[model samples]
Target chain A: MTTTEKIRGLILKVAKGKLSQEALKPEARLSEELGLDSLAQSELLVLAEDSFGIKFTHDEVWTVATIGQMVEVIDSRLAAK
Target chain B: MRQSAGILGTGACLPEQVLTNLELAERFGVTPDWIFERTGIVQRHIAAPEQACSDLAIAAARQAMENAATAPEEIGMVIVATITGDYTTPATAAIVQGVLGIPAVACFDLSAACSGFVYGMIVGSHAISCGFCNKVLVVGSEVLSRFTNQTDRDSAILFGDGAGAVVLGGVPEGYGLLATDAGTCGTEYQAIIIPAGGSRLPPSAETIAAHLHYSHMDGNQVFMFAMRVLGNSTLRTIEKAGLSLDDISLIIPHQANRRIIEAAAGRMELPLSKIVINLEQIGNTSSASIPIALHGVLTDGRIRHGDRLVLTGFGGGVSWGSALIRWHSPGSDQIHKKEKNDDNN
Candidate 1:
């Protein structure tokens, strides 16, 4: 699948397998709209590392905001790989 | 193969002062929803300024002894598991022993952070099985509120003060402690730590200014370690006990975070209902989590005769442990009698 599809799947998993389909849109604000708290944000980073087989620093993981930003981070890591 | 120690009774003592999520949110300048969503804690008990680990231990131990129909002189060993002892020098068990009037029997402190209580149970049971002790009092108490850095929202929002205890004694054959699995990944010791006030750094004015005495944690690292170790230890203990996952009646894990516990339950393929969790009522109480959660389940009548249970924990020391037990109360018949007597008197 494309990077976008993979990112969407990861977002759903991070949301505990429940979220509106529209919430996966690139422009969706993860904090304001999806409600990922600091703890959840950390968890998402850990999960993202595992899912993409890429590494992220704690700050890198916790700092990403919108779905588009997270996707971009993942895409960059993938390209580097 | 060896003498199995039975859980005679369990008692918990949570301080009277309750700190609510809303109050913590206001103190940390965060939304109440953020606190709840992050830690799954609704409220936590705060110890009074004068209260110490030994104080809570005495209260909980008294209740446990009474529940076991055991007098002070009958206890042959007192084992306390704590990370927040009143002092780092004298063992907290000695203080508890003195206050409980349990004579000069064996007394000591064991520190494995959140895994301390589960570790204590194994040590206490080994003492019993080796014929060195017949009755042991195992208490896990912590006054973490004192050590918590009120300014650090990450660490501050997740801890509370409380104590829990259990009396260990002989039980009927086939119904007692079955097996235990304990581990420590010391390499990750830096994951959750208090940076100073030890031999490594010693106490200094600079250290004090830096507030190095307070806990510092890598939340991401701890969360990863706990989720990985908790479920695996539970499975290993059950396997060691010659039982399967289906045989488990309940799993009581260290009450550090609700999300970690939920992930562990899922990994174990057990429903959340099968796990005993009281963190929502009393934020992470360190070593007290297992006993506190155990007491919660026991009092609710969720643990019954012949049921299998696993008490698992993971925390500082980068440690983890699990103890499996086949439930059978040694002094169950006395619980009601004591309750009625308490009512009458």
Candidate 2:
């Protein structure tokens, strides 16, 4: 699968299918468009960490916004190590 | 092959006085529901004016000895885990040793904040496994009510006074501690701290006026740190033991907040029914949380011989730890079964 496909899969899983098709766009804001709260974001980060075996710090997690941004951050974290 | 040390028995002591959330709400000018919503605390025990941390520790230690059928002379060490010890000069374990008349036994104390009990188990287990001692008494005792700012709702509502203890001795190899892990992030040292009364900022009239003696917490930061570390350390410890998640029967986490534990459990994919929680009855007893909860669950027979239980906690050193223990109560031993049967009759 492509990077976009993998990222979309994670977003869907973390959001519990709450994200609409339109919200799947790379530029869609995660919190504003999909209503993921802080706790949900933390859980999402945990899922990402476990799935990819890559960790993100608290500051890195807070800066995440769009689904595209989360994918980029995960990619960067995975690459950094 | 390392000798294995497991908990022989457990005991706990909470102060007689009960302070309900309604009472604290009246004092703090917040509704009881508001307090409950945030902290999940119903009532907490407060130490009396005459009571010290050692007083509670002695009571708890005695009970643990009785339960373990361990004579005072057989215990080669007494280790106390606490921040609110009886005195800063003489270790609180030394005081307990004196009171129990267990002469010449090694005694000391260590500070790991709320994670003290987990840390104690690691040390006590090592002591027995290394043949440094035949038996060890490990106690987590705290008089947090004394350090709490009566008017600071953030911390006052979260602390209580209590102690819990366990007798540690050899269990059959392979049925005791499987794995243990611990870590400290000193960079976050100030996440939960009392700014004064240490050598760096010794007590003074000015400090008292400033109320620098009371505990302070960065609640948001601590919550995030707690949720992240609690599950991570537990899973890591379990994996290190060469066991999978399916092998775990119970998880006794630090009884800090219901939401923090629940959130971490969700992240870890562990069910709520598998976790032990007692903060509603005792509030946050800091180092005493895990042992008191352990004692509670053990008393009610929620745990049994050969059951694998994970004990995990995080606290004020910016510290956290986990220890995997296969339960082995003394009463379950064949040598004690006859005595236990007679006593039951």
Candidate 3:
């Protein structure tokens, strides 16, 4: 799957029943727009790591703010590999 | 004239099945010793599949009444503190009252999590002091084992099932409850809670699939919150009672974990010996921990008449409370004579 598609899929999965495809826009803030709090955001990161087989550092968690930003980071990591 | 409602009697009941740390560790993919070192929980009781929270509450309530030599008819109210109830409609306290045949007493459940018993004590004491009730039965009961996820090490090892109760009756001057403080911070409710199974997210097959029925917690945040609140509540209660820390002969804290208790005690400059620690045997019985510890201490003869005691607790809803009580018992001779005289009648 493309990086954008992967990130989008992971967000939906972690949202549980709270968010849906219609609600998630590329630029939407996860906490404010999507209603994922700090704990939920951390859980999403864990789920993404497990699904994509990539490990994230503390810095990366902060650096990747939006879905699009997350996709770019994952794409760069995939290119480096 | 202010009437004082002293703790007339106390009792606790643990389920027959015990789950040890070693057994739980194997299931959760963690080291038994690590669990012990972190929480100091060695074993915990698990209710039988057939038993519910009310069953345990009833048993403990019966024991408390028996010890107090008080009949059900004399109880003016019943307050059960628990998060896990048999159902969402009828309060568990009502069910317990029905089972015990104390229909006249007003009954309801309170949801302050681990601090519940102390909260209940405060409420019951207030009712008696205001002459609203002459006798009150306050209980903290939970069947947390039924709601805990066996595979989740963070929570599974930290909870167990049990119930504890205390009977409160009017005392003479210079005795009974002295002061109480209770507070809640709903803004941090997400720190520890069951994610679903409420009006916000009604239970469904989807919720079930997501494991929303089980307890979820952020251990690190809860740990920080507990330490701060435990110390704050204790200090507030002591001050409110117009006494210093030195006046407190015992500190009955909720048995969430040993580290939390130790950290709070360190902050207050209190010795560990004065604090009651029973989490090793029963884990975190939530609301039941305080009364269970109270019963344990009383049964062991560690607490005596005229001793000053401070009870405190903190838990989910980020709720916390503390109460200062002076121990005073109606003379055993009077109790014996009353029983003998009653038998003759």
Chain A TM-score across all models, in listed order: 0.82, 0.80, 0.87
For candidate 2, lDDT tens digit of each residue in B1-345? 678899987889999998899998999898998788677899899999999999999999998888888889989999999999989979999999998988698899989998888898999999999989989999999999999998888888889999999999998988778899999999989989999999999999999999999899877568778888998999999999999878888999988887678878877788888899898989999888888998888776677678899999898979999999988757424325544665898
Residue pairs whose backbone atoms clash in candidate 1: none
Cα error of candidate 3 at position B253, Å: 0.2
Worst 10 residues of 3 chain B by lDDT: B330-339
Could you list the CA RMSD of all candidates, in the order they appear?
3.5, 4.4, 13.0
Model 1 chain A: weakest 10-residue lDDT segment is A37-46
Docking class for candidate 1: acceptable
**Candidate 1, what DockQ?**
0.32
Model 2 chain B lowest lDDT segment of ten:
B331-340
Q: Write the per-residue lDDT of candidate 3 for residues B18-98, one digit (tens) a residue.
A: 999889888878788878867889999999999999999999999888878888898999999999988897999999999
* Ten contiguous residues minimizing lDDT sum, candidate 1 chain B: B330-339
- Candidate 1 vs candidate 3: the lDDT winner is 1
C-alpha positional error of residue B308 in candidate 3 after TM-score superposition, expressed in Å? 0.8
How many residue pairs clash in model 1? 0
Instruction: Supply DockQ values for each candidate.
Output: 0.32, 0.20, 0.02
- Docking category for candidate 3? incorrect
Query: Candidate 1 on B1-345: residue-level lDDT in tens?
Result: 577788998889999998888888899888988888778899889999999999999999998898788999989999999989988879999999998889889999999999999888988888888889889999999999888898888878899999999999877778778889999989879999988889998999999899998999988778877776888898899999888988898989899999888765654566787788788889999998788888777776677778899899899989998999998855754445545676898
